[model samples]
Each structure stands twice: as C-alpha cells, then as structure tokens.
Target: MFKEIIFKEDAINKPEKGRLPTSIAVLCGVTILALCTLLVGALISTQRHSEGLQQVVSSMLNKSGVENPVTAVLLNFRSYDTLLEIAVLLIVAIVMLPQATVSKSLSLIRVQQSADPGLIMSSLLRFLAPTLIIMGGYMLWTGAYSPGGAFQAGALIAGAGILIFTNVQYQVNMQSFAFRALLSIGLCIFILSGFAVALQTGQFLEYPQKYASAIILFIETAATVSIATTLLLLYLAVAGTQEEFNHDA
Candidate 1:
C-alpha cells in the first residue's frame, strides 16, 4: 500500500508526444533566451552608480581593521544581513531534516547475512572520528589568523560523521529534531552574541578594541559548531538507513 505512494512509477503511463529534434530545439531556445536575459541584466545593472558604490565599499574596507576584508564586511558593517543569512541557513537545515516516509515494499524484504565488519572497522572509525574532529577544531580556531574557517572545518568534521555512519552501527536521520536543534544552536548563539554586542555598544556588532579578538573567537567557535552539525545532518539526510538499534545486544 505505502509502496504505491513512496515508489510511484510516473513515466510508465505518462504521455510522450514530442520528437527528439523538436525537444532539443525547444531546450536550446530556452537556454539561449535565458543566457541573453542574464547578459542584458548584467550590462544594464553595472552603471556609473555601481562604480561609485564599489569605490565606497573599497574605501570602507580599506579603513577597516580586520585582517580579512570579507569577514569584516560580513560580520561588521553588514551584520544585519548576516543575521538573516544565518536564519536562512538554519531554515534550510530544518527543511532538510524532515521525517522520511517508510516504504511498505521495503519492509517486505528480508534481511540477509553479509560479511562481518567485525572489530577492525569499529577500531578504525573510533580512531579516525576524534582525529578528524580535532582537525576541524584546529581549522576553525585558526581561520581568523590563518587559512581555514567554519566551512572547511565543518566539512572535515562531516567526513568523520560519514565514516561513522557507513562503517559503524549508528544512524542519524533527518527527522530527528534533537540533531537539527544542535545544528541550529550555533547560528542562534552567533546572532544573540551580535545582538548583545549591539546592546553593549550603540553600534550593531561593534566589538571594543580590548575584546575584539575574544569576540571574533567566540563567533567563530559558534560558527564552527553550527557548520559541523549542519553538514553532519546533511550527510545523514542523504545517507538513509534501515538497521534497527540494539541497545541490549
């Protein structure tokens, strides 16, 4: 019953009236029109005023004290937009982690014995998970002063999660709200910290010179946590599971 719903065969009964050449021509026409529209929009948008805006941005960034100009703009002058961007990221995480529908046909399949992974995979994953997680931490911590940041760290940490999911018995699912909340907390903390900074100083996200490094550190830590959790959740959403948990065994 649920199989019919979950695995619907749409193409089997669907009408197929178009010839290959006609379909190809229609697709090419749409692509060409889209490219032309984009070209025209770009040409019209970048005028004299746009150049003035660019100069203003360059001047402001030039005066900023941050080592990374992009970070300075994102976390300082345009902080309000950054807040909304964080919110959007949280929303995307939430949307991606919804409960999956169970298929009845899948339930009918019997479990068969496969080659045992035994102690080797378990030991390897146990060793690798911590190592990768530590690497991620290091990457996040040095982002402000060095080459890595939250995204890079998160990706590294997610590699560990994938290893665990594939080689170990545990499985994380998109429908799990606890996991989603863990992912969202980092972004929430960041936004709240920014707001707190605003309260302390009249300007939004204006960190005092005395605590500049500390504030950036805190924000980066939060970003690292959130990014790692979100990426882990993304991996789980893509990697489905059917194994039952056996706590007593």
Candidate 2:
C-alpha cells in the first residue's frame, strides 16, 4: 500500500515538472510570433513612407544651417533625438559602473599582470595610439562636410584608450573626480549649449544662422570627449570586475 501511494505521488509530480517547461515554451513561441508580426508591420509602414523622406530632408536642409544633409538632420532638424540618445548612453554607463564602497581604494595597479600583451603589442600601441587620436580629430572635423561625426571620432579615441589600458601597467579609478567629470562632460556641454541657444533664440537647440557652425562644432567636440571617456570607463568596469572576481577566488 505504501509503495503504491509513493508511486502515485511520483507520477503526479512528474507531470507538474513537465508542465512548467511546456508552458514556458508555449509562452516564448507566442511572444516571438507577436514580435515578428509587429516588425513586419513596421517595415511595411517604413516602405510606404520612404518616398516622402527625401522631400522632407530637402525642406528641412535649407533652414538647418548646415551644408551636409546628414549633419543638418542630426544636429539641427532632429537635435532633440540626438540629445536623448546621448543621455541613454550616459545612463547605461552610469548604471553599469560598480557602486563605491568604503573598502574601495585608489591606487596604481597592473591589469592582467599575468597575461600581458607582450613587447610587440606594447611597442605597436606607442605608434598606433597617436595615429588613432589624429584620425579621430580628423573625423570630428570632417563631419561638417563629409561622412564623419562625434560618434566616429569618439569610437576612434576609445579604441586608442583601450590599447593604452591593455598595454600599460596602471589601472584607472573610475570613482576619481576627474574621471567622473570627463564621463559626464559631453552631456553637460550639450545641455548647456541647448539652454544657451534657447535663451538667445527662444527655441531649444535652434542655432542662430550666424553661429550655427561654431555651436555645432563645439557640441561635437564635447560629445567626442564624453563618448571616449564613457566607453573607456565601461571597458575598465568590466575588466576591473573580472579581475576582482579572480582575485577573490
């Protein structure tokens, strides 16, 4: 009798175990199907709207105060969108960074001391880093007339920073005042510029025709620095966490 009751209980629990997984699989399939339907609808709508996009671009370009259509679209016609995008990146960086604790200390420490990039990589970084800096600046400057902007320039600068971090022997303290300031500087400058413009023209981010180019250049330069610093800090945060984990183990 006891054995029969135990077997019956096992059988009942077996189905319950399977039910959870089955339900989860069904839920996932339904969710995916719904997402696919939404994506298709969005694509169809975009296709329908494609014809008028050029006309809209042309209409906005004249009042945008920039020669490059892309630049004008990003910095003048749709600047609020750009501001929100930067804020998103900044927020992500802030969220991903580890919180400070009383135990945390600032000091020069070696990263991946046992797994150095070796003499060849270290030597290459010396020449490569400066070149990337120059390229990044060039890209920032050319963004006014050509196919480059703050993002591209910032990426190049971040690449250079990564190389330096990996090849060199010092660890950066993300909590440092200067480092924190650099991380937020771009967004700060962008906001201040927007307010300044608003005060002058009674419209947010609406650059006066005479000062439009200068204002855009200033914003881009600050954005590049902010982007580079933020990216480098993100890299450091990941690496630092991993190193701490390994050390604890």
Candidate 3:
C-alpha cells in the first residue's frame, strides 16, 4: 500500500560558462572605456592636424615629383615610413620562407597537392597568370603619375604567382641567393638609397628635387619585386608547409 517517494532537493543555480564574473566584467568594461577615450582623443588630434597636413602636402606636391598625392606621400614625402614597412615585410618573409625538405625537391616551395585541370581551365589560368604579371608591371610603372603603386602591383603579381603555384608544377628554390635577393631587394635598395642620399645631402632619403622622379621609380620597382616575392613566400609558408594543407606543403 505504501509507495516509496523520493524527495529531490532544489538545485543551486549555476553560473553560465559564457558569462564572466561581475568583477571581471566590470574590469573589462573599464578597460574598454579607457581604450575608447584614448581612441577618441587620437581621432580628435588627427582631425585637428590633418588640415595643416593637407595644406602642406598640397604646397609640396609638385616638389614630391608625383601627380598622385597618395603616391607622393608614400614614395616621396614620407618614404622612410614606406621603407620601414617594406623592411617589416622583409623580416616577415625571412621568417616565413621555408627551407627545402630532404624529401622534396631542392626548392623552397614544393607542390604537395596536385590538381589536373581541364584543358580549357588550364589554358585560362595560363593566360590569366601572365596577364596578371603584365598588369602588375603596368601598375608599378604607372605608380609615379597614377593611383597605383608598389603594394598594388605586388598584390596583383602575388595573385598570378598563386595561380601558377596552384597548377601543381611549381618548385621554388628558396635556398638560392637570387631568390633571397629578390625577397630583400626592396629593403636593401631603400636603405642603400637613403644612405646614398644622406652621404650627398646630409639627410637620409631626402631625394634631390631634380632626380626625385627617377629615384621614386627605382624604389618602387625594387619594392614591387620584393613585395610580390615576399607575399608569395608568406602564402607558401602558410599553405605549402604541411602535407594536409590544400596548397604547396
């Protein structure tokens, strides 16, 4: 007649895994507020100074030897900053460029994954690859007077290189001095030219007004080469370094 009944005690509410403790949440909120304040201050400062900067750039545009204000700033007025950028890329490339494995070909890059494209697709890629390189060259050449520049040229060229790489026939020799030279040429030329200018004018990278155009062209050319190769090397380091990867590992 007696049915055994089990009484269940009330369970304590558990804090959610996704929710932070109140103290931590408050701390994070305070940190975010501080960052927002700093960012707002920085924006205000930049806004206040930008008007003067634009006027200065406008006045000096002709002297910078480029029709494009952006290119003038990047490759002439503030070239050191661009040099530093390329140097950083060079460092990244050096870090990312893989050494040839014993089992792979004596090249820095190896095609770990193979693909057999249809004739039409293959022909299209081949056509596009060379076309991209030509476009990159045009971009580099036009940077002095137009909107394009070394970075744009490098990106376009890197795209072509990736297309070629994916065709499963690439075996780049990273161990070659020529390959490294191409990867570092931008930074090397930048530093050397800056020092050369300094030796003549007592200020590094202060290009003479007479030769500014030629110098900018030279630097951009070198930068395009290095930037493109470095970018490709970085992509290879990411995609080509492992067999399980979908690329040159």
Candidate 4:
C-alpha cells in the first residue's frame, strides 16, 4: 500500500513537470504573437493620415482656463475620468483595510530588530520627508502651467509616508476615522463639484470658463490629500498583514 501511494504521487508530479514546460512555451508564443500584432497595428495606424485630437486640443486650451494642456485635458476636458479614477483608488484602499474584528493590538507592532533602520537611514529620512512634502506641494502648484499635477504630488507624499512608517518607532492607524475622512474627501469634493456645475449648466462636471481654473485647483488639492492618504493606508494595511502573518508563524 505504501509503495502504491508513493508511485501514484511520483506519477502525478512527473506529469506536472512535463506539462509545465509545454504550458510555458505555449504561453510565451502567444504573448510574442500578441505583442507583434500590437506593434504592427501601431505602425500601420501611425502611417495613415489621421487628423487626431490636436486641432480639438488647440481650441480646448483657450477655453480650458489653464495654461497647461495636459492639466486642461485631465481636470477639465476629461475630469469625469479623473473622478472615476479617484473613486477606484478609494475603493481599493477601503478593501485593503483590516476587518472590524481584527484586534487593535495586532494592527501595529514594533519593527523587527533585523529590519530596523540604522542612524544614517533615520537621518536621511528626516531630511527627505520634509523635502518630499515641499516638492509635492510645488508639483501641485505647477500643474497649472507645467508638467506636475495631483497624481505626481500624491505619489511624492505617499513616498514620504512610507519612509515615516518604515522607521522602527513610527506607526500609522489605518482604520482611524481621520484617515478614512482624508481618503474620501477628494471623492466628496469631486461629486459636489459636479453637482454644483450641474446646477448652473444642467450638465454634470461642465465648469463655467470663468471658474474652471479655480474649480480644477480645488479638486486637485482635495485629490492630492485623498490620494496620498489612501496610498499610505494601503501600505500600512499590507505591512500589517505581513506582521500578522509573521506573528502567527
């Protein structure tokens, strides 16, 4: 009986080893074919005389109430898309949060001695955190006329949050009310702005040209805060899960 069981297990494992290579080869071939098809399609499409959105964009910038074309497109021309994107990020952060029954004690604990940062890292973080915050604010401000925007700003701020949380002594409460509020504030502002515009123009998100820049700026500011908070919470949630697993082990 022991020999039969061992033979059956070996047979099962042997087939998997053979099938694994075959499956990998098939997947590789399919991926290569798909990529080639996409490249060819791109080449053919670009060769055609296609009157793209350039003309429309040129006209849009004049009435967009912003000097930056990219900003105008993101916050004005296609703002509904940006709103939806923010909602998606909020949903992801909400999903990542620990369950209500999870013990508060298990949510955060001291970093393992092996993973603790040395003096140099701690000193660097002190300088980098403030610099990142200032840079993020600058990015948000310059989004109106240059390359930076809320997304870039949010990422920088999130990086700073990550540095703070990774230090041995720091902890963030992912489930706190203030954190939740900050995470949702952007979405709230976005929805309210849409309704306000609807009240005036009978169309959702259609900002008046006179107030377009101001409205966009307000939305961007809220979005920056919400995005940063949401991302930081996500990191904390992931780190908490890992810590829980390690404790269990």
TM-score result, candidate 1:
0.65
- Winning model by lDDT: 4
Clashing pairs in 2: none
Stretches of model 1 off by over 4 angstroms after superposition: 1-19, 22-65, 100-127, 173-180, 242-249
Q: What digit string (tens of lDDT, one per residue) describes model 1 on residues 1-249?
A: 012332345545544454357777799889999999999999899664546455665676534445555555666567577667767777777787645553322322222234345788879987999999999988877665557766688789878877876664554533444555667776777777877777877776776655666676677677667777777767656664533321211
**Tens digits of lDDT, candidate 4, 117-179:** 789878989899999999999999999999999999999999998887778655555544666
After superposition, which runs of candidate 2 have C-alpha atoms over 4 Å from their true positions?
Answer: 1-50, 101-117, 241-249
Error of 4 at 198 (Å): 2.4
Query: 1-249, model 3: which lDDT tens digit per residue?
Result: 233343446435543355567898899999999999999998988744447588888899999878888899998888989999998998898888665443333445555335565577579787898899999999988887778999999999998887776565555656566778899899999899998878777899999888888889899999999999998887767776344232334
Q: Which runs of model 4 end up more than 4 angstroms from their true locations?
A: 1-19, 22-31, 34-42, 101-117, 241-249
lDDT value, residue 68 of candidate 1: 57
Provide the global lDDT of candidate 4 against the true structure. 0.82
TM-score of each: 0.65, 0.73, 0.73, 0.78
Candidate 3's C-alpha runs over 4 A off are 1-50, 100-117, 241-249
Ranking by TM-score: 4, 3, 2, 1
Candidates in order have lDDT scores of 0.65, 0.79, 0.80, 0.82
Predict model 1's lDDT versus the native.
Answer: 0.65
Ranking by lDDT: 4, 3, 2, 1
